[model samples]
Target: MDIKEKIRNFIESNLIVFEDEAVFTDDDNIFQMGFVNSLFAMKLLGYIEQEFGITVANEDLDIANFSTLNSIVRLIGKHKQEV
Candidate 1:
């Protein structure tokens, strides 16, 4: 229902590989967890923009912003404030 839970659900649902869902946490490094590939990050970027109505700038695209639920939430908050 919250942002973290929404992100966690989205990532788990979109995962290409079937791994133990229990392995994910709000702060889990999704990339390090092997939950996504590079292109998937782009897909997630689009989802963030559409779902949160925030545009992520080119400079903001990086693992530091997309690698965890909490980080994505932070990125969304940052962009929302810029609106």
Candidate 2:
């Protein structure tokens, strides 16, 4: 599957609010959708680390980089390249 599909599946599996039916895109606001909060974002970071096999620096944990599926896909692409 593609990056968006991966992210969407991850969110559906991990986050309670992001069910299988939830709609998302690169421009969708994860914060605004209530899909992610400060607490949940941490969990998301961990999930990303485990699923993508990449390390996320503490300084890189910010909403701007992860506010949408598209942004997250881009970040994951970069991380995968580094790996």
Candidate 3:
């Protein structure tokens, strides 16, 4: 329904070991969420790029933009506006 829900659903669907009972809030550290490694991060980036139709550059791969769902949504909004 919303961005948070969308992100949660995406993660849940894609991550096989991700349990539904895990605490996933807007402020939760995605890096500390256990299942997120470099490979998973890249996969997530691919998904974001494909889903939102935006190219995420190497410089944009920092945690500032991809830290959480809220941050990622804001980054996507900014990218969409620029596009």
- List the candidates' TM-scores in order: 0.87, 0.78, 0.78
Clash pairs, model 2 backbone: 26-70
Q: Between 1 and 2, whose lDDT is larger?
A: 1
Span of 10 residues, lowest total lDDT, candidate 1: 16-25
lDDT of each: 0.84, 0.77, 0.72
Q: Number of the top candidate by TM-score?
A: 1
Per-residue alpha-carbon lDDT of model 1 for 5-74, expressed as tens digits? 7778888888977766547777888888777888889889889989988888989987789998889989
Candidate 1: clashing residue pairs, number: 0
Report lDDT (Cα) of residue 48, candidate 2.
83
- Cα misplacement distance, residue 22 of candidate 2 (Å): 3.7
Best by lDDT: 1
Candidate 3: lDDT of 4? 59
For candidate 2, write residues 1-83 as lDDT tens digits: 87688878777666656375566676988778876677778777887889889998777777877878888888888889877
